[model samples]
Target: MKILFATSEAHPLIKTGGLADVSGSLPSALAHYKHKVRLVLPAYRAVMERLPEKSLKQVAKLSVGGCGREFEAVIWQLKAGAVPGVDVPVWLVDIPALFDRPGNPYLAEDGADWWDNGERFGVFSKVVAELAMDRAGLQWQPDVVHVNDWQTGLVSALLSVETQRPKTVFTVHNMAYPGNFPHSLFAQLQLPESLWNLDGVEFWGHFSMLKAGLICSDWVTTVSPTYAKEICYPEYAYGFEGVLQKRAAEGRLIGILNGIDEHIWNPEVDELIHSRYSAEKGRVAGKQRNKAFLIEELALLNGLSETRIQGHLADWLQAPLIGFVGRLVEQKGIDLVLEVLPELIEQTPANFVFVGSGHKSFENALRDLAQRYPERMWVYIGYSETLAHQVEAGADMFLMPSRFEPCGLNQMYSLAYGTPPIVHHTGGLADTVVNATDENMLAGTATGFVFYDPSRFALKSTLLHALGLFAKKRSWQKLQKTGMQQAFGWKASAQRYLALYVED
Candidate 1:
C-alpha cells in the first residue's frame, strides 16, 4: 500500500501537540510493515532549518492557487533518513511567503492565532490534493490519503470533486479546534462551490475545515474508541454532532487508540533519563536512584536515597514522588490538582513535581504553591524533553486527571516507564488504564488507578486510594510490572489502519 500521510505537524520537525507525535510514529510503523509511506507537511522555518537545502532534492515546481492568489511552490524530498525510526520518504511543500516565519506555526508572537491561518493551511491542503491526484508531476500516487486534524482537513474536501482519486481517511485528533473561519473567506480561498452547502464544509454560517473532512472523506476516525463514540453527542462534538452522528449511523466512524514510539520511550534504551531499568531487572533500585536524582535536580528535600548505593536503602526513601507533565489548563483538570494539592501536601508524605506551561493563571498559581512549600512541591513552567523522560522514569506515580482526552500518549508512556498513572476514567484513559480494583488486582490484570466523575473530590480520593496501594511494596511492584508488560506500540494500531484502507 502506498499511503500519503498528510499532517500540519510531525515530531522532530515541528510540534505543537500530540498530533505531531501520531504523525511521526504511525507512518514509520506502517513503513516497517512493508508499506510505502510518503510523509507530507508544510515547510515551516523550523522545518527548513533542520533539513539543509543541499540535502533536499527538488521534486517538482508548480503553481498553487489559494487565498485568492496564485503562488509558486516547490516540492522537495529527502534522499534518505527522512524520519529517525524508519526511512520513509518526506515530501515538504515549500512556499516561503506563507510558512517562512518563526514561532508557533499557527500563531503570531502575541499568542493570538495568525490572521492568515485559514489561508496558510488552505494553500497547503491544495498542494496535498494535487499530489494525491497525481497532478504534481511526481508520477507517484497514493492508494490511501490519510489526513489528520483540521489543519489538513481541506485535503479531503478538495479531493471530493475528483472521480478517480485515492480513498481518503480523515482523523480527528481533537474536536475542540475546528479550524473555522468567516463564511466570506470561503469564497476568497476559492474552494469548490459544491462545498458551500451544510452537508459539506459550511457550518452555522462559517466555513468549517473540520466539517469538510468529516463529510467528504470516505472514513472518519478519532484517537480512541470511546472518543469516537463521544463525538456523536453534543458534549464532545463541539457543534458537529449532527454530522458525526450521521457518519456513525452509516458505520463510517471508528476509534483507533494511538501508540507511543517505543524506540524513544522505552526506559531500558532511553538516553534522557538518569538511569535505565526494565521490568525484569533492577527496576526497584533503578527507580530509587532516578527518584533521588530528580529530588536533587528539582531542589525538593525529601525522598532522596541517602546511601546513593546500587541496592535499595531504608524505607524512608520509598516515600511517594508524584509527577505531572502536560499543559496546565482547566481541561487537563489542573485546577483539580491545584484544589487538592494544598491539603494533600499538608496531610501526606508525597512530594509533587510539575513540568509544563499553559494558562497564565494556572502558571502563577502553581508558582505560588511551589514557593509556599518549596520542599514538597516544585514547578517548572516550561517543557523540557529530558525532564519529561525523567519524570516518567523517576516518579512513583503519574497524575493525568484530564476532564476529557481524545487519546493520551503520556499515560501510555508512563505505563511503559513503570510509573503507574492515576487518570480520570474518560476517553482513552478509560480504554487504556485498568483500574486497580480488588478483582483486577487478584487477577493480576490491573495496570493503574482510575477515577470516575469530573471533580476534585474524585481525583483526591483516587490519589489517596493509589497511595494506599503504593504503600504495599509487593502489590505496587506487581502493578508496575503489569503496566510495563502491556503492549501499546504503533504496530498493532497501524495494522488496524491498514485493515481500514483495504476494506471494500
Candidate 2:
C-alpha cells in the first residue's frame, strides 16, 4: 500500500509531543512491513539544520493559499533511512518565512502560541490535501492519506470535495488541543462561507479543524481503545462528544494503541544510558549503577544508597528512586503532584528526579521543592533526549499520574526499561499497566501501580503503596520483569493500520 503520512511534527527532526513520535515511528513500522510510505511535513528551520544540505533536493515550487495571502512553497525531498531495507521519501514543504525563525513550531520564544499558527498549519494541510489529489506535480498518489492531530486535521477537510480522492484516516492524538479559531477566521482564511454551518467546520461559533476532520474523513481513530470510548463522554470530549457518538454509530470511529520505536528506546543497546542491561541478565546491577550515577549527576547526596533509613536495604541500596518525565502542566497532574510533594518527601522514603519544563508556576514550585530537599529531590527544567533515555533506564520507579492520557509513550518506555510506572487509571495508562492489586499479582499478570481519582490524596496513597512493595525485593523484581516482558512495539499497531488502509 502507498501511504501519505501527513502531520506538522515528526521525531528526529521536530517534536513538541508524542504526536511527533507516532508520525516518525509509525511510517517506519509500515515500511518495515513492506508498505511504501511518503512522510510529508513542513520544513521548519530546526529540520533544515538537522538535515545535510546535500540531502535536501528541491522537488517542486507551488503557490499555497492561506490567511487571505499566497505563500510560495518550495517542496524539498529526502530519502530517509528510517527502517531497514526501506528508504522512505520525505516531502518537506518549505516556506522559510513562516517556518524559519522559531523557538517552537507553534510558539514564540516567550512561550505564547504564535499568532499566525492558524495560517501556518493551514497552508501545510492545503499542500498535503493537494498532494493526495495528485495536483501538486507529484505523480505518485496515496492509496490512503493518514492525517494526525488538529494541525493537519484540515487536510481531511480540504480533501472532502474530491470525488476521485484516496480514502483518509484522521487520527486524534489528543482531543484536548483542538484547532479552534474565531468565526472571523473563515473570511481571513479564505475558506468557503458554506463551511460555517453546524455539520461543517463551524462548532458553535468557532472554526474547529478537528471537528472538520472527524466529519469529513472516511474513518476516525484515537490513540487507544479506552480513549476512543472516553471521548464519547461530555467530560472528556471537550464539546465534541455528540459528533464522536454519531461517528461511532456509523462505525467510522476506531482506536489503535500507539507504539514506541524499540530501536531507539531499547535499554539493552541504547548508548544514552550509563549502563546497558536486558531483562534476562544484569538488570539488577544495571539499575543500581544507574541510580548511583543519577544521584551523583543531580548533585544530590550520594548517601541515599548507604543511609539505611529502613531495615529493608539488606546492605544494598537504601531508598528507591522515583522519576517524573513529561511536561510540567496541569493536564499532566502537576497540580496534584504539587499538593503531594511534602507528603512524598516527609512521609515516604523515596528520592525523586524530575526532567521536563512547562508552566512557570509548576517550574517554580518544583525548583523550590528541589532546593528544600537538595539531597532527596532534583529538578532539571529543560528536557534532554539523552537524559530522558537515561531516566527511563535508571529510575527504579517512574511516576506518570496524568489526569488523562490518550496514549502516553513514557509508560510504554518505562515498561521496556524495567521501570514500573505508577499512573492514574485513565486512557492508555489503564489499558497498558495491569495494576499491582492482590488479584492481579496472584494471577501473575500484575505489571505496575495504578491509582483512581485525579486527586493529590489518591496519588499520594498509590505512591505509598508502591514504596511499601519496594521493600520486598523478590516481588518488586517480579513486577519489573513482568513489565519488561510486556511488549508495546509497532508491529501490532502497524498491522492494524494496514488493515484499515486496505479495507473497503
Candidate 3:
C-alpha cells in the first residue's frame, strides 16, 4: 500500500516531542515492508538549516487560498539508505511566508504560538490534499493519508472535499492541543460552509481542525489503546469526549499502542553514554560503570564528597534508578512527583535523574530538590538527546508518572535499553507497563512497574515497592532481561495501520 503521512514535525530534521520520532520512524518501518511510504512536513527555517544543498528538489509552484498567491514547494527527499536498510522518502513542503520565518516551528522567541498558525497549517493541509488528488503523477494513489495531531488535521477534511479521495486515518497524538480558530478563518482556508455543521468542522461555534479530522476521517486513532478509551471520558477528553464517544458509538474510533525504533536505542551500539552494555554480556559491570560515571558527573556539577558518591551508588544499586525524561508539565504529573519527593527520598534509596524543561513551578521545585539532595537527585533543566540516552542506559528503573500519556516513547526506549519502567496506569503507560504480580508471573516477559491511582501516596508506594524488588538482584536482572528481549518495533503497528487503511 502507498501511504502518505502528513505531520508538522519529524525527527533528525525537526522535533519537539514524540510525534517527531513517530513521524520519522514509522514511515521508514512501513517502507521496510515494501510499502511506498512518504512523509509530508513543513519546511520551516530549522528544517532548511538541516537540509543539504543537494537534497532540495523543486516540485512545483502552486497558488493556495483565495489570496491567489503562488507558493514554491521544494521537496527534500530523505532516502531510506541513510539509516542503514531503512529507506523512506520524506517530502518537505517549503513555503517561506508560511514556514521559513520561525524560531521554533510552532512558537516564536516570545514563547507564543504564531497567531497565524491556523492559516499556515491550513495551507499545508491544502497542499497535501492536492498532492493526494494528483498522486503527483506517481504510479499509485495513496491508500491512506495518515494525518497527525491538529496541525495536519485539516488534511482529512480537505481530502473529504476532493473528488478522488484516499482513505483517511487521523491519529490524535494529544487531545489538549485543539487547533481552533475563529469561524471567519474558514473562508481563508478556502473551505465551504457546507463543512461547518454539527457533523462537520464546527466545534462549539468555532472551526476546529481536530474536529474536522475526527468527524471527516474514515477512521480515528489515538496513540494508545488506553488513551483511546480515556479520550471518550469527560476527565481526559479535554472537551472532545463527546465527539470521540460519538465516533466510538459509530465504531470509527480505534487505538493502537506506539512502538519505538530499537535500532537507535540499543545500549550495546549507542556511543553517547559513558559505557556500552547489553542484557547478555555486560549487564552488571557496564551498569556499575555507568552509575559511577553518572555519580562523578553529578558530583562535579554540584560538589559532592566521595562519601556521598559511595552512598549514592550503593543506594542506586540497592534499589533501582527510577528515571524521568520529559517535559515537566502538569499532564506529566510533575506536581505529584514534587509532592512525593521528600517522602520518596526518605523511604526509598533509589537514585532519580530528571531531564526535561517546562512549567516554572515544576522546574523550580526539581531544582530545589537537586540542591537539597545533591547526592540522590540530578536535574537537567532542558532537553538533551545524548543525556536522555545516558539516563536510559544508567538507570535501572524508568519513571513516567504521567496523569495521561498518549504514547510515551521514553518508556519504550528505556525498556529497549534494559531498564524496567515504573509508570502511572493511564493512557499508553497503562497499555505498555504491566504490573508485577504473581498471576502474570512476568517470568521472562515483564517490562516495568505500573500504579493505578494518580496521587502522591500511590506514586511513593510504587517507587518503594520497585526499589524493594530491586534488592533481589535475581528478580531485577530477570525483569531487565525480559524487557530488553521484548520486541516493540514498528512492523506490527504498520500492518495494523494498513488494515485500518483498507477498512471499509
Candidate 4:
C-alpha cells in the first residue's frame, strides 16, 4: 500500500516534539515491509536549511492559497534514509510567504502563536488533500492518507468531499490544542460554507479543524491506548470528548503506543554520553561514569554550606540519580516539581538534574532552587540534543511527572538506555512505564515508579519509595533490566499501522 504520512514537523529536518520522531521513523519502518510510504511536511525555513541542496528535487508546483490569490507551491522531494535499509520519500511543500519564517514553525520570536496559523496550515492541508486525490500535478496517489495532530487534521475533512478519495486516518497527538479559529475564517480558509454546522467542523462558536478529522475520517487514532481512553473523558478531551465518544461508539477511535529510534537512542552506539554500554555488558559501571560526568558538569558536588547538603554526601553519591528532561511547563508537571522540591530535598538526598526550559516563572523558580541546594539539585535551562542523550544514558531514574502526555519518547529512550523512569499515571507515561512495586517486582513485571495523583505529596511519596528501592542494588538492577528488555521500536508499531491501513 502507498501511504501519504502528512505532518507539520519531521525529525532531522524539523522537530518540536515526539510527532517529528514518529513522522520521520514510521515511514521507513513501513517501507521495510514493502509498503511505499511518502512523508510530507511544509518547507519551513529550518527544514530547507537542514537538508542538503542535492537531496531535494523539485517535483511539482501545486497551486494553493486563499482569498482568490493563488500561491505556487514548489513541491520538492528528498529521501529520509536515517531509519536504515529503507529510504522513505519526503515531500516538501514550499510556499515562501507561509513557511519561510525564522523561529519555530508554530510560534513567533516573542513566543506567541502566529496570527495567520489557521490560514497558513489551511493552505498546506488543502494541498495535501489534493495530493491524496491524485490532483497535485503528480502521477501518484496514496492508498491511505495518514495525518498527525491538529496541524494536519483538516486533510481528512478536505478529502471527505471527493467521490473517490483515499482512506483517511487522523492521529491526535494531543487533544488539548484544538485547531480552533474564529468563525470569521470560514471564507478565508476557502472551506465550503456548508461545513460550518456543529455536526461537521464547528465547535462551540469556532471552526475546529481538528474535529473535522474526527467526524469525517474513516479511522481516528491517538498516540497511546491509555490516551485514547483518556480523551473520552471531559477533562483530557479539552471540549472534544463528545466527538471522540461518538467516534468510539462507532468503533473508529483507536490507540497505538509510540516507539523510539533505538539506533539513535541506544547507549552502546550513542557517542554523546561519557560512557557506553549494552544491556548485557557493563550497564551498571557505564551508567555510573556518565552520571559522574553529569554531576560534575552540573556542579552537583559544590555549595556544601547548607547542612542538608553535607548530611547525606554518601547517599547523594550512591543515591538514585533522578533526571527530568522536557519543557518546564504545567502540562509536564514542572509546577508540581517546583512545589515539592523543598520537601523532596528534605525527605531524600537523591541527586537531581533537569534539562529543558519553558515558562519564565518555572525557569526562574528552578534556577533559584538549584542555586540554594547545589549538591542535591542541578538544572540546565534550554534543550540540548546531546545533553538529552547523555542524561538518558546516565540517569538511574528519569522523571516525567506529566499531567497528560499523548506519547513521550524520553521514557522509552530511558528504558532502552537501562534507565528506569518515574512517571505520573497518565497518558503514554502510564502506558509505557510499569510501576515497580513490591508485588510487581516479585511478579517480575515492574519497570519503573508510578504515582497516580498529580499532587506535590503524591510525587514526593513516589520519589521516596523509588529511593528506598534504589538503595537495594539488586532490586534496582532488576527494574532496570526489565525496562531495558521491553521493545518499543517502530517495527512493531508500524506493523499495527499496516493492519489498520489495509483493513476493510
Best by TM-score: 1
* lDDT by residue (tens digit), candidate 2, 369-393: 8888866787888988878988898
Q: Pick out the ten consecutive residues of candidate 3 with the lowest summed lDDT.
A: 77-86
Error of 4 at 479 (Å): 1.0
lDDT tens per residue, model 3, 251-283: 999998887876788888888888888879898
Give stretches of model 4 more than 4 Å off.
82-86, 300-316
RMSD of each: 2.7, 3.0, 2.4, 2.8
What tens-digit string does per-residue lDDT give for candidate 1 at 156-241? 99999998899999999999999999987789888789989978999999999999899999999999999999889899999999
Q: Which regions in candidate 2 have their CA more than 4 angstroms from the true location? A: 82-87, 300-316
Q: What lDDT would candidate 4 get against the real structure?
A: 0.85
Give the least accurate 10-residue stretch of model 4, judged by summed lDDT. 300-309
Q: How should the candidates be ordered by lDDT, best one leading?
A: 1, 2, 4, 3
Which lDDT values do the candidates have, in the order given?
0.90, 0.86, 0.81, 0.85
> Estimated TM-score per prediction?
0.96, 0.95, 0.94, 0.95
- Candidate 1, which segments miss by more than 4 Å at Cα? 300-316
Q: Model 1: how far is 361 from its true place, Å?
A: 0.3
